[model samples]
Target chain A: MVLPSFSNPGAGPADAVVAASPTAPLDAFLDNQPQTFYESIYRSEAACLCILRLLPPVCRQIVLHVLWSHQTLKSADLKAFCGMDERLAPDAAEEVIRPARDRHIFLSLNHKGNKFQWPLSDTFKRGLRNALTGLGTSNSFGAPYARGPRDEVPTAEALTDYGEDTWESILKYMVSSGLTNGYRGGRPRNSVLLLLYQSGLMADPYDRSGHNPKLEALTITSKGFQFLLEDRQTQLWQILMYYLAGKQARGENAADILSLFFSLGCMQLGQDYSASESFPHMENVLDDLEQYGFVYRTEMGRERGQFFPTHLSTTLCSGESGASRSQSADDKRFLILETNYKIYAYTSNDLEIAILNLFVNIRIRYPNLVVGRLDRRHVKAAMDKGIAAGQIISYLNSHAHPQMYNHPPPILHPSVTDQLHLWDKERNRLGAQESVMFEFFSRELFDETRDEAERNAGLHLALPAKKLLFVDPNVREAIKDFIKDKQVQLRGGI
Target chain B: MSYHDPYQVKASNGTLITCDSAAKQILIHLDAQRDGPQKFIIRDVDDTHVLIKSIYVDMVRTSLQEELEKNTYDQDPAL
Candidate 1:
């Protein structure tokens, strides 16, 4: 059986890029679904299009080739098409065919008088063809709402601002929940709060359950710290994955939710989609998604409303890096780090300030700039709260001011980065091991046991002068047997 | 010579501490204090090494940091 290329030793740099890319989690999530789930979801054109977009370029080429051809192609044909010979066939199979097959996009069959031929899954092929040619029922992609003359259509800029504000509020809540008394400002919806706790990103210090969990009682976990360091797209997907997993655990149908996400991914940003006509019975899910900033919905008084897919949903399967999506032009390079461990941020975004405050000691704040210093005490406190030194360093490096980039590579000052790393290393000075300490009465017995432990590669420490030996706990029984054998030898000799 | 049941074996989940001889001496001193019900050092292996209880590793590290901080010089300006 072929394994995913990411897990293989000889996987190329392209595979490594895909593995580190944001789409990797979505790809892995789809690959982990049961065959039956694929059979059902692949029937939708939107799901097929989203999944196709998520595949590696090589896999996409193979799928497109197989989709057009009626004949089953052998591995040799596939390798030749992908510009590889027999020697590289194994790599192609491992990298391309394995993942596609795992997702049920391609099926490897034993054809008559031919070794394993590849064919696209029938349902996936039909759905993808219809999606590309716009031939099938167009309901897979949400129906565009016909706006009335009196309806006020929101501009793209307004929609983007709305989505960002709603999203940033959730992040602010997570950050402030870690503060001493928590922020007294607006909190995200209770469903989001519950999802944060349920996803293990936040915990109640008092472990109280049932009904609304107090915002101050919640504390961000280590995973939450790591999540905060991630790009906005990754952060969004992480929450959605946790939500889907939670739904699955509660015995709810997650396939419907998955399909909805894929349908949203195929949607156009700022285009209004009719809720009643497009999603039918998924109004509650749509409302919940609106709360998470996936979509912006007009108020529904007595009739059905329309929802506009935000940038978050439109780029869900596009695999665009979060850096491009999250960074605004004005604040793209807002941070300036000095050799003396000082940081000057050129924006007034509260979320950025809160994130910087995770590891930096904020000294002063101005209208458009904030000055902070990275010191041992504050950094160590952040580390104590489970923020890694690497995350802090990367955050600084990624946000370095354009002036800093004017110099050569190593954008952040090397001294500052080195000092941060050293501070992190300081916490790992001691190493722990569970072992058995053997105190021998006779020098001969100690020597015998120490040698035995050494042969087994279980010796932790040995003091020949003091007749003491420390061996791994796992090898204690073997050491005892060796001692018994040595005692028998000594008795027989006497 | 009689071996007398060969050897006595004791097992524990321990943290192997390796530091300078002076730091080890400080650790030994700290372990000797009866400030808490539990001591830090499990056994002194050598001049520069000690086996410590894993549970007290953080406490031992903090105390060691505090002891070492007295000799270090700070050059950062007051904020």
Candidate 2:
């Protein structure tokens, strides 16, 4: 509270950054949060874990180093820590402090000589320290089952397999609508499925029951297609954001719900975490977790149940366990993209087939495999649906079979990558635009204006012999202004 | 007039559908689970003004899947 300078709370940056940072999916949480919201979050041990997990490397180092010293560091010190000089103030602020500062993650104080001091909240500092050391008495982290047997605990590997199956069911659920007879098995937990519809992930077809709408029917959206291809971490956060938003709309405390998620994330997989001591909302949290396979609940008689953290539970924490689950999927690369524009994907996974269909024209589906081609019409169809060409190429590159990566630098075949990009660029070449067409009797004025404006290249088209010009509509206003000024100059001369 | 959004265009034989040109949102025909047989995304102008396309969750999966099955056949290479 030295200077109380961390004031200009940033809902604007939060909202814009969250939705706008489509590349950084984790930034979605930072969206639409006011300073007070962040303050309340920082005060809780569980919520602080949520924020601390997403801090970029440099910001993390600074927070940890600052929190440990129990002293505020000046903005200049932060700048220096980022290896930036005083002259590079803007870059330093943007690269080092802006995200945390914008989110009001750091408390800023005005010290002597106009320097600004930044520190972590005491509650946040204590919370993170306790999480790292497992030292605090706060029950934010759920405890183990009472009188639980040591012999029956599930192993991490078993939890991971179950995590993959159930979690992937949700993904498969999206594409099922696209596949003939693809929808199968019970859908994801009712809430998660509803969240999909509610979040506009997968949509239901048209309904007009007049005050009673249909919720059973569902289909994937273009955004849902994009979600399928996103890195696992981004996909998880996207669901959480939508789910939490829905919960909050129902009048629940969002920060507490988030803290519960983060606390569960930080726990050990396969361990039985107790309920009564921590997580007063234990029943609700477990019910939600069961859907996502975050925890397995067991009840003995009338007493409240004990919960176990599945490997999926660690999806929110560091990528170690998450990485293990991902490696299994990534281990045997399913896709093979050839220079001849042919695609051979080895997998019975319907979700992969549906995604491949986004940019590839499938030729045949055999047992355990499918063959396809990256054709012009297919690519354009994807583009028309708002899926970008670059996304297609990268998806191919990441899933390329191991043999394909044998070349130096280990990437997709250069010719295939080149052709994919070339096709994208070629198809986008011809575009129609609205323009202001001009015709004049005076050749001199027309020639002069055309010379000056057409310098923008490809933007202005002229039929010189006919004394006509077509100016890009965007530049029409600017050209009008220029003409008015020219008329003023001519009048002055007269 | 804003052409009453999802404004329909007539085909030569007299069915109202959105033809290729000047169409923003794709007009898809669907057999709605709740509303019975109908065209998706686009509905009768008389329907509620609140029918939002974004939040509309059902898709014409059955018909679309039929069309996709045809596509799967066409894509088969000469063998």
Candidate 3:
């Protein structure tokens, strides 16, 4: 099945705009083939928790209400939670259940001689309950370390710092590939790189089918461009989903692996947990995750070593935007766009520079900043690579410098925004579209054919003066049949 | 992230109809509804030569409608 577009079908202008821009993990799941996504989710407990977290607040509530029970919950049963009285139609309740059902979060169960009803996902049920209440006996919430001198445990601030640094380091690794001399740091773990290739976020230019590490042959795919701008949680879920799917394919117990990680996310940040708590499940993957900074380990040499979940893990379930100011506060300002085409990003973060270099022409570099201009060639290069003008504009708009942000409209210069799109639109000026070219017909016949094709939404281009027309290939057969019928009629009449 | 829409603006009656051809490019800016003077630009797509001058709103509208009716201008007019 084709991936559904990121845009919501009937969203209003404002929502349509948001939907047009990429980076929604929920939308990604929706856009993905259901069988693949469902298999991915059910294979791991953490993937289940991720689906719960990725859903909108209302949808999550639906999952929570039905989570405890194993019985098939009728869509009508949800009426009590929603307080939709007898006045509300049963179909309305079904409508309420539709989104979750569509996403396969609620599987339809076939009870013997009974109406089909949505069954709460068991793996998700257990994992979410443990995550929310922290009362479950299962090791799904992470194991607590034996009482230790608390002074040795790392603080939340330190973990957040570690998470940010390592996360940036991974991005730096990715961004380096876009540069002339590739990024020189110790690369991210092989598993993470493989996840990138599997997720189609990055591809080897020479070898589209397989990756060879020795050649360092990978270019960030267009999907990678948007992936770079995703918030940490979305990025984490995207990566983790791919990781779980890959492991599951290899016959590993990926479901347990996912659950173990979800437990890690549920644990208190900076709290020390014994490795045995998560046990055999976390033992192998924990080292791989360390490269992602999802967790930090102290005293790796010891058998019962302690692991602390970083900000990345802690923020996985509930993002920080739950506060009253539900949207972002202007705390993050990474890019500055000037009135002129020049862009001055205030941080020599190599990853950020490499990303900017993708669509913006870099002119000069400084210790703290890199100066760049977004010209036609720079924009076309990104467009040619499959990154849309809208995504680049959205990234710049979101990451605009604090001073640049004017309340009603975000702070990037209007010209820069318009020109980026204009350049992107320019790429579409002569895009190749396959169509059936019709020519050498009489003027009267041509007019008749053109009118019929246009009415049917099959006409591609028409040259009335030349009595030539082009139409969609699918409709060509019909036109040919009509022409044959006309020829027969002419012969019969003659 | 909050985005500033450069194309869309509040309460501006100005409409920009851009049409591309094999030989030339045209941009017709009509602001008659907003009671502002209008202009249109015709330039070679190959960047050979440029022609820019003011035009009456009716002329731009007629030209735009002619192009629109012919289905040559596939892009919707930007408001």
Question: Which candidate should be chosen as best, given DockQ against the real structure?
Answer: 1
Candidate with the larger DockQ of 1 and 3: 1
- Specify the CAPRI tier of model 2: incorrect
What stretches of model 2 exceed 4 Å from their correct place? A1-23, A79-83, A86-95, A150-152, A208-213, A298-303, A319-332, A348-350, A357-371, A376-386, A418-494, B1-76
The DockQ values of the predictions, listed in order, are: 0.37, 0.02, 0.03
The segments of candidate 1 whose C-alpha lies over 4 angstroms from its true place after superposition are A1-19, A87-92, A109-111, A208-216, A322-324, A433-435, A438-494, B1-26, B32-39, B46-49, B71-73
Question: lDDT by residue for model 3 over A1-494, one digit each (tens)?
Answer: 12223332223233244344222543553555444446654444455666676566777777876687666676456677777784565556667767666667776644445343567656556656655665555565566778555536678888887888888887877777766687667677677778787878878878844746333566677777667766455677678777777787889865466556656666787787777665554577877777788888766424565678887777666633322111234434667887777788887656677778888888789998888777666677778777776677667876788777564563665667666656655554422334565653455566767788887788766667655566676787787776556555544564
Worst 10 residues of 3 chain A by lDDT: A1-10
lDDT of candidate 3 at residue A167, scale 0 to 100: 83
- Can you give the lDDT of residue B38 in candidate 3? 38
- Which one wins by TM-score: 2 or 3? 2
lDDT of each: 0.76, 0.61, 0.61
What would the TM-scores of all predictions be? 0.84, 0.68, 0.67
TM-score of 3: 0.67
Q: lDDT at A6 for candidate 2?
A: 20
